[model samples]
Target: MKKRVKQPTADVPALDDDGPFAGDRQFVGALYRGLEILRCFRPTDGPLGNQELSQRCGLPKPTVSRLTYTLSKLGYLVYLEDSGKYRIGVPVLGLGYACLGGLRIRDTAQPYMDELARHAGSGVLVGLGGRDDLSMIYVACARASSVVSLQLDVGSRISLARSSMGRAYLAGADEAERTSLLQQIRAKVGEEHWPRHEEEILRAIEQVRTRGFCTNIGEWQTEVNSVAVPLRTPRHEMPALAFNCGGPAYLLSRERLEQDLGPRLAEMARKIQTFGST
Candidate 1:
C-alpha cells in the first residue's frame, strides 16, 4: 500500500494573489495581513504559535511572527508565557461584540428562531448564519429545551457545501458570487470529491427555487437533518443571510423538515424581510 500525499487546497491560498484590488494604491497590505491573522482564530481554537498561525493564514512564519507580535502589543492578542503562544484578547471581544451589536437583524430574528425551535420540539436547534470564507458562521442560535440538543452555539462554523443553511445562501446569492463561491468550495474539497458536493448544492438550489427552502439529510453530519431558507436583506451592504431549523435525525425526520418546519422558516424569513424594509 502506498501512503497518500495531500494536495494543495484553497483553504490556504497565497496571501499575495492579485485580485480586483491588486492595482489599488490605497489598499494596505500590512493591515490586510494583520486582519487575516486575527481571522484565522476560530471559536474552538486554543492559543496558537507562530508556526500554526503561518500555516492557517498561508503567510511565512517570519511574517506571522511580526504580525502576531504587533497584535499582541496592541492588545488584540495575549501572549501565553508557559505555552509561548497567543490567544485572542479582550480587544478582539470588543470588536466582535460591536459587530454583532450593529446587526439589528440578530435581535429581530432571535425571537422567531426561538419560537421555531420550540415549535419543532426538543432536540431541535434553530440558527441564523452568514457566509464566512468557505464556511457558514452562526451569528445567532436557539435550541429547544433539551439536554440532548446539538452543542453548537453562536460563532460555530459549519460546512458551506453540505449544510442546508449554506445551500440556502448560495440560492440567494447573485450569479457571479455564487459561481465564485462554488468554485472556491470545489477547490477546497479537491477535484476528486467535488462532483458529489456540486450535485448536492445544485439539487438544494433547485429546491429553493421551486419550493421555499432546501434540506440536508445525513449530509453534513451523518445523523443530522435540516431545512433552511435564504433571508435577503433590505440593506444591500449587509449581504444575504440564512435561517435553518435542524437537529438529530431521530428528532427531525425528512418528512417533517420538508413539510412542516421548512415552510415555517421560509415564512419567518419573509416576514423578517418585510419588516426590515418598512
Candidate 2:
C-alpha cells in the first residue's frame, strides 16, 4: 500500500467568523465548529489528522482533537489507527442521503432532464445542482452521451463563480443571499482576480434575465461548454438550484447551446418548477 502523506500544517487560513449569524447569541459555536470540521472533507480528500483539521478549520489542534473525538464517538467520523487520521463515517453519508431523498425535485426533474440531454446530442450531460458554500454540488445527473460525458456524478462540485449552473443560481437567488455569496467569492479569489470573475458573473446574470439562460463557453474549463437556467425549489427556505446541459466544446458549439439547448433547458426548468410547487 502507498504510504499516506500528511500535508504540511502551515499557511492555511483560519475559518472566517464573519457570517451573518456570527453575532447571533443563539448560535452554538461548538456545534458550528464541529460541522465545519465535517465540511472540510471533500470528495477527493483522504483521512485527515487533527493537525490538518486544525489548519483547515482554523481551530487549535486541541480543539480539533476534542471535536474529532466527539465526532468519532458520535459516529459522524471514523478514526483510523494506521493513518492516525479520521474519515467521514457512515452516519454522515446517511444524513446526506436523507437530505437528497427529501428533495422531490430530483425525481420530478430527472426524466425531463434526460430527455433534454438526448435532444442536445451525444457527449452531453445534464446536471441539477445546488449551492454548497462557494461551490455548486450536483444533486442529480443525467447523460445522453453513452460513450463519453463530463466526468461528473451526483456529488461532484463546480466553481460557483464560473459554472453556468452556479451563475443561473446566483441570478435566481434573493438579493441579500446573492450579495453575501459574491462577497465570499471575492474574499476567496482576492482583489487581484476579483474583477474578471465579477464581470463574468454579472454577464451571466444579465443573460439569465434577458435570455432565460446563461452560457459558459470555454470559461470554467478551456474545452468545455455549457448552458444553464435557474430552477425554482418547492420551498422558499431551500437553497437555490439550477439545471445545466454541458459537454466538450468540440461537441457542443456556442451557437447550438445558445439557440437550441439553452431554451430547452429553461423550458424544462419551468415545467419542473410548476410540478414541484403543486
User: In terms of lDDT, which candidate is strongest?
Assistant: 2
Q: Which stretches of candidate 2 lie over 4 Å from their true place?
A: 1-20
Tens digits of per-residue lDDT for model 1, 197-251 = 9999999999999999999999989999999999987686565899998899998
Worst 10 residues of 2 by lDDT: 1-10
Task: Estimate candidate 2's alpha-carbon lDDT, on a 0 to 1 scale.
Answer: 0.87
Instruction: Check candidate 1 and list the clashing pairs.
Output: none
Tens digits of per-residue lDDT, candidate 2, 1-278, equal 32333343545333344434787777667787889999889888999888899898788776677778889999999988777899999999899899898887899999998898778778899999998888899999988757888999988889999999999999999899999999999999999999999999999999999999999999999999999999876676555699999999999999999999998999999999898878
lDDT of 1: 0.87
Please, what is the whole-model Cα lDDT of each candidate in the order they appear? Answer: 0.87, 0.87
Q: Give the TM-scores of the predictions, in the order they appear.
A: 0.90, 0.89
Look at candidate 1 and tell me the lDDT of residue 7: 42
